[model samples]
Target: ERLHSYETKRANLQAIERLKDHLISVQLTDPSSKHRIRRAVSEIGKRLSSIRNLLRDRKLELDCAVNAAENFQDDLKKLQKFCEQTEKAIQLVESATIFVPSGTDLDYVRLHEPEADEVANRLEKQWKDVFSLGEAVIDEQFGIVSFDTILEILAV
Candidate 1:
């Protein structure tokens, strides 16, 4: 609605310009009448120019705001997906380790220790990557989810 109003005002300004042009083309015999018309045209032209500039500046500001919002949302989604993947990986490690007791079977432990170690290494790498992503989000001022909240989730 606001945009429509701006456009309407702009159209009116253009019409005013055409009228001013036609007025200027008219041959006026009185010096005072000519001077008055010229002064009015100059004032109206300055005001129209000012209005156009204001609209342009406002449009640029709106565009920048929209782009910033989109970038922030994209960053947020990326961070959220990374966190979910990391959580699933952590759950997998937990579930894998839970079934192995202290003295259940030496053979089973021996068979799975290498695999467990590999999982552990991968989990560590995942943590490092998640940390880096968190830092990047924070540095970019998009840290809507606090590190403490993330830490609490990880602790669970």
Candidate 2:
């Protein structure tokens, strides 16, 4: 189960990386490429949502295990590390910029893509979903079931 969680995260990170590359490539090209890039970005946003949900579920499982254990110090540390990594991953996507044409007297360009606005909104929603799960894990740690229960459920 832990291995599955790691694989899920790896796949998500790869997807994000691919999206970043596509965005960068589009930025380097002409304005006509915006539509294609926008589509790619939208697809990436959907992938991000799926990945976040997977991670959130795994996080809950980890939280349950931690709560059931006698010592929470190490588990707490791991949780902190995971939180930091997650934040970094989100920041990576948030920091990505795309160029757009500026309509003004002065010769200037917009830094972020207008097409990405909707994608960003979707990404924000996914982030909020994952954050809610994180909050629930923290608040309901003791109430979560133990590994034995999970194993039994899996067995059936």
Alpha-carbon TM-score of each model against the true structure: 0.52, 0.26
Candidate 1's residue-wise lDDT over 1-156, tens digit each? 877987787787678768766766777646676667677877877887798789899999889868866754564454445455555555555667546433334444445545544544454454456457743334433432454554454443
Off-target runs (Cα >4 Å) in candidate 1 are 1-7, 17-29, 97-156
lDDT of 2 at 4: 82
Model 1 weakest 10-residue run by lDDT = 135-144
**Candidate 2, run of 10 with poorest lDDT:** 104-113
Top model by lDDT, which number?
1
TM-score of 2: 0.26
Q: What's every prediction's RMSD, in angstroms?
A: 10.2, 29.5
**Model 1: how far is 41 from its true place, Å?**
2.3
The global C-alpha lDDT for each of the candidates, from Candidate 1 onward, is 0.60, 0.52
lDDT of 2 by residue, 30-126 (tens): 6656566666767876776797789789889989766645234444344344444444544555665774323331111122223233333443454
